[model samples]
Target chain A: AQSVTQLDSQVPVFEEAPVELRCNYSSSVSVYLFWYVQYPNQGLQLLLKYLSGSTLVKGINGFEAEFNKSQTSFHLRKPSVHISDTAEYFCAVSERDSSASKIIFGSGTRLSIRP
Target chain B: DAGVTQSPTHLIKTRGQQVTLRCSPKSGHDTVSWYQQALGQGPQFIFQYYEEEERQRGNFPDRFSGHQFPNYSSELNVNALLLGDSALYLCASSLGLAGGGEQYFGPGTRLTVT
Candidate 1:
């Protein structure tokens, strides 16, 4: 079984400011990590995923996440954010034994970009 | 690609009534997975269908059932719905890679159970 935890429920930041969204996971087997974004009245879109080979994975919209094996964390970060970044971000984890099926997602963090 | 497609973008149903949602997977994709997302919450997997069979299911009660057709399209049926059943129902499709494949998601069908 796998579980995902996103520490912050809401994060407010001024436009152009750097931000980080934290995520951690617990799984009995090897894991694949992912981040997804949901805009108002829209479905989820894949942000990025960490399968293997690289610890630091870059994704769309100038976002990146670092997978720390020991800390069991996969935190998303962006050097600078825009108002368009205001959306719900989710961190997810699936057992690597499976390709990415049955992934468990975090509760979500609502990122509000204040101008 | 057209990604995944779900029908009846928004629906309203009274409690105790049953509802059926439809989905069409992406081209060349044979697997469909369903999730329920409540307001302010992330999605929770409901089940997955492949090859016209229910391959996987979550902890949902027997009230939730699904079917996949030979054409690869699918439907989710919820019986005896409750107020909590009012949520966004999301459908995802994938290539059915063994283990875990990154499933592509559709915009979702918003169901409001009154």
Candidate 2:
């Protein structure tokens, strides 16, 4: 079984400040990792993914995450955030070998951007 | 092209009642998956439908059923719904059954059980 853990339940930062949402996963086999953002009253949108490539992955809205295999972490980071960046972010993982495998998601981290 | 779309933006159902939610996948997508999102939580996978057949499922009960049409559209049916089932139902679509590709999501239907 695979599982995702987001260390932070909520994070508040001022506009244009840097932010990092921590995520860790546990899986017996190799896995694919992803970050998704959900705005109020909306479905989730894919932020970025680490399928099989460089450790660092860049995503939309100037967000990026680094896949750390040894630490079992894929923490999302933004050098600078905006008020529009306020949303709930989720970390997810899927088994690499399984075809059409189900995704396991962490509880979620709510990002609140303040002026 | 339009992204994934789900019908009945919001629904209110009583406990023990049944409900049906519909979804249309994005253009050129063949795989449709459903998920449940409780308040302040991440989406939990319900199941996936490909080629009008169920391909994969998560840890959900039999009360949660679904069907896929030839057009690749899908419907999720929940029988004898419970108050705990009150949540946002999201529909996501992808191009292949491999499940490694990115999935586009619909706006989701908010189901409120009373």
Candidate 3:
């Protein structure tokens, strides 16, 4: 089984400020990590994913994440944020084992960008 | 591509009533998965359907059922709904055979139980 934990429940930042949303995971087997963003009243949109190869992955909207194997963490970061970046972000994980492809998500972290 | 699409953007029902939500997978995709997102919580997997058969299911009760058609469209049925059942229902689609767990999500259907 795999589970994700987003450490922050809410983060407020000024526009153009850099930010990081922390995520950690626990899995018995190799896992795939993902970040998704949901705007108000909308469904989730894939921000990025780490399946294999590079530990550092870039995603849409100038967002990026690094997979730390030893720490079991996949933290999302953005150098600069915009008002549009204010949304709920979720970290998720799925086992690499074909039998467990279901993605389990964290509770979510709400990012509020201030002008 | 049209991406994944779901119908009945918003619905309202009373307790004990039944509701049906629909979804159409993205073009060229063959698998459909259902998820329930409660208020203030992340989306929880309900089930997944492939080739018109349920290939995976979450911890939901038997009252939560689904059907997939030959065209890859799917329907999620919830029986005897409770106030807690009110939430956003999301549908995701992917190419199961190609592997990789990248699933594209639809806008979602909002169900409000009164």
> Using DockQ as the measure, which candidate wins?
2
Better of 1 and 2 by TM-score: 2
Ranking by TM-score: 2, 3, 1
What TM-score does chain A of model 1 get?
0.97
**Clash count for each candidate, listed in order shown:** 8, 0, 0
> In candidate 3, which residue pairs get closer than 3 Å at backbone N, Cα or C atoms, i.e. clash?
none
Per-residue C-alpha lDDT of model 3 across residues B1-114, encoded as one tens digit per residue: 799999999999999999999999999989998999999999999999988989888999999999999999999999999999999999999887333568999999999999
| Ranking according to DockQ, highest score first | 2, 1, 3
User: For candidate 3, lDDT tens digit of each residue in A3-72?
Assistant: 8899999999999999999999998888889999999988899999999999999999999999999999
- Regions of model 1 farther than 4 Å from truth: none
Writing each residue's lDDT as its tens digit, candidate 2 over A1-115 gives: 9889999999999999999999999999999999999999888899999998799999999999999999999999999999999999999998888878578899999999999
> Which parts of model 3 have CA positions greater than 4 angstroms off?
B97-99
Scored by lDDT, model 2 comes in at: 0.95
Candidate 2 all-Cα RMSD: 0.7
Each prediction's fraction of true contacts recovered: 0.63, 0.73, 0.44
DockQ values for all predictions?
0.65, 0.79, 0.59
Looking at model 1, give its docking quality level. medium
